[model samples]
Target: MMKNYITKEVLPFEGERRDLANVAREMFNRKMTNVAGGNISVKVTPDENFSYDEVIYEKGHDYLLMTPTFMSEAWYAKLNPSQILVIDLKNGKKLSGEGRLTREINMHEEAYKANPKIHVVYHSHALNCMFWATLGQDMPNLTEVTSVNVPLGKIKCLPYRTACTKELADLVYEELIKLGDKSEQNIFLLNSHGVLITDTDLHSATEVLETVEWNADIAYKQAIFKKLGIIENYQSCGNSLTI
Candidate 1:
């Protein structure tokens, strides 16, 4: 019954299928998810054949598809597309029963509404992002790498709210708008929560999250080495080369 429901109305595309699997694997391998910690979703394009006002482009088709919650990231990596829930955004209906739609579905909805260009949303409690959040530090654009990706814009922080509350949704919506005309690649730190990463597609979205963690890891390690007074002279280590 669960398998039948999940596979019922999903659109089959090898690219999207592979993307989903890759994201799941990467998240697990990187320990982005400890046990069952994060969720990933991809938005489906509305069908061109359907009229603008039509509700059902096709009975079985879904506007969004997501992985099941509570499954270990490693376990989720092995799940078939049929094991994920297919959600109809038009009416907030779930066409599949493999698992209930995540309560944070509103987060994805709000992000999509704010930025039509975003096709993927990833929410994870990454250690580095979380460390900054816990310290209540604004994620600084200190280095070229951090500035290039996260940039110099403010890292919007949403206050603690119930995971699925209307307040939480509203906060995220407002923050995105507050980002204003700046670069759309800003990363938002959810206070006492997790990181909300959105992007043009699943692959890019995953990359953005990876970059954030990478920067954080680098910063943390550098701070530790500095405390130990172990800084090495990079100029002395190698011969200079003209570019």
Candidate 2:
């Protein structure tokens, strides 16, 4: 069941809307997500007049706003308030707004439920983690960034399920719970899918996601070097592996 804390209302964000645009830009620049590959959302508290029913209102209601489906991150960041999809949290119904919501919307909701402290959720498929996940290899606790940011915990791998299916949502929820309080550890390697990152705010979450990709990239490059035996004493790179 979905949690109750996801009430609907016009969220008064702490930063300028342009900040969100910059975040999107940076993610694309860092290669965390491609044009239409990833999604980002932030939880906002509703205003005083926002009733539960008002929060639950369907797509046609007055307050619901969302970004267009499959739009490039660059294009998505340029969206106006009217261009965003707004809906009541009580029901999946669209209260008002014309934009189409992504099927992975439930993923965001599940993250919000798992940790109310998490205000931002980022979903992406980067090269490093994707390569490791495809090989069915577990991500090692590598650098200080990975250790302090992502931490050492079980990086749950979900089976190949169709995107946006209830089955996928349930599995993600289950994996998150299995992670316990460590869910904040950033970077979940979905078997054949991608990665999910949650943070107390968007900036931190974006940073963590970027770090996960960087670590994975470094590991991939180092592995190639080791296999070739190009250089000895590669252990100095801060790999968790011991010679």
Candidate 3:
């Protein structure tokens, strides 16, 4: 059942927040996520409009602006502005906006808490990404582009859990921490689910998402080459990735 905090209405957001929404629409259009898959969130501090969970998140600390679950729609449908739900992260409660907040709300919340410096998170059902997630494989930095900004070290994957549950959120938090400090984790794969990327903002997170998906796709193709004996004797640059 979809829960509502207020009447159905198209709410307006400021410039940066609006940019976040636009980027989300672009992410959707880019096939990073379908109507049913994927959610985007940004950490925001307490403001004049919201005043709950002050003690939990600290008066001036960051919370989240989570998109509500999209109802039945085509894959290419645009999400209205009213669909965005503001959440008080201290507790994943809907602070404003309408419609039900995403079932993955807890996942987004725990991710923010897992990394203090990560102010943005993008969880998407990007193709090729789901390939590695299901195969229990990790994304190795296979290119100079991915090797520098993204680490060659494997991005960890967690076991599957029912989405929108505390268990799922906890599993993500546990795996995300292995990437080192909260701020260092570039991306994580949720088993049989999707990819999650953390960054200082939406655009940066989007970049990481693109790079990670490319790496995932490349890694799979390389594995195919190995299987076909096309690169049976391939060697690496003294690393896990094959050449």
Q: Taking the tens digit of each residue's C-alpha lDDT, what string does model 3 give over 60-132? A: 6456776666622432425555556667677677666667776787787777777787788778888888888
> What C-alpha RMSD separates each model from the true structure?
7.4, 6.1, 6.4
**Quick one: best TM-score, which candidate?**
3
lDDT string, candidate 2, 138-211, tens digits:
66546676666446444444666667787877777777776677666456777767787877677887777777
TM-score of each: 0.74, 0.75, 0.80
Residue-level error in angstroms, candidate 2, position 84: 3.3
Q: What are the clashing pairs of model 1?
A: none
Error of 2 at 183 (Å): 1.6
**Ranked by lDDT, top first:** 3, 1, 2
RMSD of 1: 7.4
Per-residue lDDT, model 1, residue 107, is 82
lDDT tens digits by residue: candidate 1, 1-243 = 322112323344334655676777678678775664677888776343342222334533447777777645447456665556667766778765356577788887887777766677778888887877676565533344555544544555567766777888887778777665442455777777778877667777777777777766665565566567675311111332111
Q: Write the number of the candidate with greater lDDT, choosing between 2 and 3.
A: 3
**Which candidate number would show the highest lDDT if scored against the true structure?**
3
Better of 2 and 3 by TM-score: 3
